[model samples]
Target: MAKVQFNDVSFSYGDKKIIQNLSLEVNDGEIMGVIGPSGCGKTTLIRLLCGFIKPETGSIFIGETCVFDAKKRINIPPERRNIGVVFQDYAVWPHLTVLENVKYPLKKKRMDKKQMQEIAMNALKQVQMETYANHLPSQLSGGQQQRVAIARALVSSKELIVLDEPITNLDLKLRQEMLKEIREIQKTIGTTIVYISHDQEASLELCDRLAIMDQQGNIRQLGNDYDIVMKPKDRYIFEFVGISNFVDVVAKEDGVYINAQNGLVKLDDKSVLENPTKAYQLAFRPMDAVFDNESPIKGKVVTETFLGNITNYFIQLGDKQIRLQQSALDVMKYGKAKEGQEVGLKFVRKFYYEKEEA
Candidate 1:
């Protein structure tokens, strides 16, 4: 496996700069995901790394080879970069059979049938689509077709594989299954993978590390799932990761505190308050807002959803609404909650941030 590094890379169409001064590395044998909102340059970053687009400034290195370096006038073509890319479209040949599609890249290397078939079949069996090897891509379902595309991308002995929203079009169940398969395959192949997606849930679950970008082409935060979730670099990342419990916290000389709606007192660690607030948005996951039947921080049970394993509570707290995630067993113990039933709430966890400046 080879490490892929971007050093202060920047690119744009004409005058519109899509990526600027961006630099990051995908370590060998690790899966790193690039996640952001639509039009936040996720795809552009991938293209740049794949050598589809050259950086207008700085360099991109695959292992020690400088694929793109403006200063040195070094630029390598995509086909010569030794990186396999599976784009959003699957990019499979409609007229080609599954096995043929997988064999396409190997043919460029002049590999024989036995050699090519062995690689293709192994890839197909990994995706559980080996039986459909002789069928064309059009004859397979979307998920199966994608598996073929994945197999084709892997047919070559490349050190890095970059996938752009590999499971975007699949249904929920298949999406979940594909994520597992992709992560497993990356491990089995021992190839570094850079996956790009806008889905935070998917990115968090599948990636070893992740980079969250913003509209201005800034790489906002880059780290493992836990670090990003527990200590987000900013409000954009905090909210994007789906931990939406923002309380109006004020830092005083003593401790950080928030008087949530209905007199719910939220106290932060004194250590966080010792320094002036670095962030304006004090956030926490909805799951952290623990509920009890015997506390003073009271709120009405506005709604509840039974989701088999986990029952979600939609509580109305003064002027603000908050969500609580609890087990179905807890819901069974509490009985069916009536709308407007006064319930006790307390802040069990919190993350503080300084206010955003417009």
Candidate 2:
């Protein structure tokens, strides 16, 4: 419906800077997720987009309208921005019925009572909460209350919506169902959405593209889930996206070698390292490594954990402990390794990164 753009936006709270020279664009009719740990300014971005706070520099655009521009001195109020917001707590009025809550936005425009009722009922139907229009939020379940809040937001602004950790309080099953429902609604109406959350897995499941932020409030990477997970741009991205293992590695005349408990074990694939002369560490995901008896790379199994879908193995390589995962099917095919067992490791895929300073 509408594309959102932030051009060289920067914000600060007194002496502490939150965002700096951040530029990003969200395409029309797509779900763009902004994910990062707490204190990374995810909420600040939402506030800036909603016109609740002014940026120290740069401009922001929604579709063709310049909502906020520091140089141009153009500032649009939040009420006039026509951006809907859904919060994590399901910000529904407990006193009002579902229909009344949805109609509250239309009341500000002084639309006729009948016309407002019709629009509100239509929005309720869109979220599949039509039958409970007369029910109060207190009478509804957590999921149902969320649906009411979503309907209210839709009734207010159909073009652009911001969902800030909307389903974080819900149970696991309810969270999944809510995500599915949101996707269905988006597909049907083609509303551009900005979903902000710290949950990486949920963001991956719901978003079309993800923007990952670091502690300094800078976007480290922005791409699809596969690229962010498999082809991370830096060590921070790799460690933040999923479970990762980093082992100290040294380059030798023969090949690259991983520092092991017994001695240095030569890596099977020397081509993984782009620059063998520079200091680098071997980095790989838990699912990327496999136990091989013939491989020279070895580790002692410190512990083994049986998760429902996958088996987790904690292997001690020298003094550092790393994790490896095997699916249930894999365990059925190849027997599980015992604790304290010396196992040979072969990496199916690996990356080399310079060690970060402490």
TM-scores, all candidates, are 0.89, 0.93
Residue 254 miss distance in model 2 (angstroms): 3.9
Instruction: Give, for candidate 2, the lowest lDDT window spanning 10 residues.
Output: 269-278
Per-residue CA lDDT of candidate 2, range 161-235, in tens?
988875355777877787888899899999999998777988898999999999999999999898887789998
lDDT of each: 0.79, 0.89
Q: Give the clash count for each candidate.
A: 6, 0
How well is each residue in 35-84 modelled by candidate 1, as lDDT tens digits? Answer: 88888898888888877878889999988888999999998988888877
TM-score of candidate 2 on Cα atoms, chains taken together: 0.93
Clashes of 1: 6
